[model samples]
Target: MQQKPLTGRLILADVARGLALLTMAIYHFSWDLSWFGVVDWDVSGSPGWRLFAQLIAGSFLFLVGFSLVLAHKSGIRWESFWRREIKVAVAALAVSVATYFIFQDQWVRFGILHSIVVSSLLALPFLRVHYVFALLCGAGVILLYHWLGDYVLPYRQFFWLGLNSLPEVSVDYVPLIPWFGPVLLGIGCGDILHRYDLLRLLRGSASPSVISRCFAWFGRHSLATYLLHQPILFGVVWAGVTAGVLSTNAGDVQVRSFQQSCVMACSQTVDAGVCEQACRCTSSEMMNRGVWEDLLTRPNDADVREIAQQVFQVCLRR
Candidate 1:
């Protein structure tokens, strides 16, 4: 057997990145199922599926930090750094542009890839710092997040600033600020591992046997996988929905279930009651007007804006 090349340093990270990517795919599959009327998106609260998704985001970004440290611990080069930075930055911008076209009503303004790009640049100064310093900075950032999260949500301008407010209209919104705190923590972790050479130890001796090589393969190309999987999943769900295999309207008290789910999911932006009431009201109104299909299959900006306002009014302003 040809001993796998790039197998040493890349080992743990490859596996970790793969697992995170898979988890993210699962989460998005759930979202697509909901979108296609196969199921309701778990928007109810932070209790069940939501917790898993957060864990996935944290893992990926931490890995991003970890990867950065691994990429350049041996040396620093402005040219190489800028080259990698440009690649990531371009991809991030592409994501924003494509999403803006697809979901103009709720396009990702600054999502996970954007975080990775910016956080990588931000992590530069601290790359050579002691783990102790990185730890302290992480703690400070977390504290600041808690202190100011609520205030940031109220100001529309602060949405881009990435604190307090929920991601607007975007399917996946991973902001900076407090979220970056976690990435910083990951950097601290990388520093400790690099300084102590613990990563080598983990690969050689400490890793769980159950993790296996398959999962690691997923980690290696996680970015490409992430980009491709969603469309495939959505296409499947969309076909099912079009074929009437999935029902947009679940009927009777099931509508309440939908409302509850929406309320719980969107409570980050506002209270659950607001979402439930608004969605229920809008759904009911649309049914009465015989325009429920329009709400569900909005093809233009006007329809998106109109239905979004209707949904917003019931959930937010109420």
Candidate 2:
């Protein structure tokens, strides 16, 4: 038999979300530092950093699924659901628009919020299904993507399906296939919690520490924190750069890093000699034209982007 809907908010979930938010902030700070050349390592490309990012994304998606069950286990609250969905959808659109203007080359078209909007809708039917069935479906989705994720569909619009051979240039690209698996798994877990009345016990438990309480607060306002934290962190780093507290050699470091990454990426499709020559050509040209620093700091600036594109074309012909 099905159990009644669990009453009240789950404190543990909020604390978990708060902790996730904290870790996310830490990761973003590292990314910001790297972007400003304060760090030598590439936070976006490092294996450890990539793994951390994936785990954080998975936790948030899982919570999305779990929260769905918590809110609608008794019955679908259509009004509340629509209200929240519209808000999330709007926020996702705003992110896409904002990133497009800021990072024209690698904007976020389908990031975490976008994924949540789609995955939440897809996960709705699973809420009424058996927990074991939901788990099975989740495993199947993950396995399917693992086995066939490399096959490319021949369209740019299909990139968000996770089945296309698109460049991994987007700031955030959370596709529906494997990512949706986490949501299904979260739903299964939530179902089990309700079945055993575990949520009620968790809700009654007191937060043991002030830190935990703080995390809970952040968790309760996770969306706002997610949206606002990056701009604030970026501003802080930008201010440090303006004040001359950060490294002045950032341009040199950035150029070197770009050459290394470009060669690595180019080598995958061409000979080492060709990759090295092209990257060196592009790097030298940008440096010669005095656009390297501007390109890094103001990637979206029209004049910088135009000059950068011309440099790339010139290098490609060499």
Give the count of colliding residue pairs in each prediction: 8, 0
What are the lDDT figures for the candidates, one per model? 0.69, 0.82
Best by TM-score: 2
- Expressed as tens digits, the lDDT of each residue in 46-79 for candidate 2 is 6799899999999999899999988898899999
C-alpha TM-score for every candidate: 0.74, 0.81
RMSDs, each prediction? 6.6, 5.9
**Model 1: clashing residue pairs?**
18-219, 43-264, 43-265, 44-264, 44-265, 106-169, 274-315, 278-314
Per-residue lDDT for 112 in model 1? 86
State model 2's lDDT: 0.82
lDDT of 1 by residue, 48-77 (tens): 766787788888888877777777655667
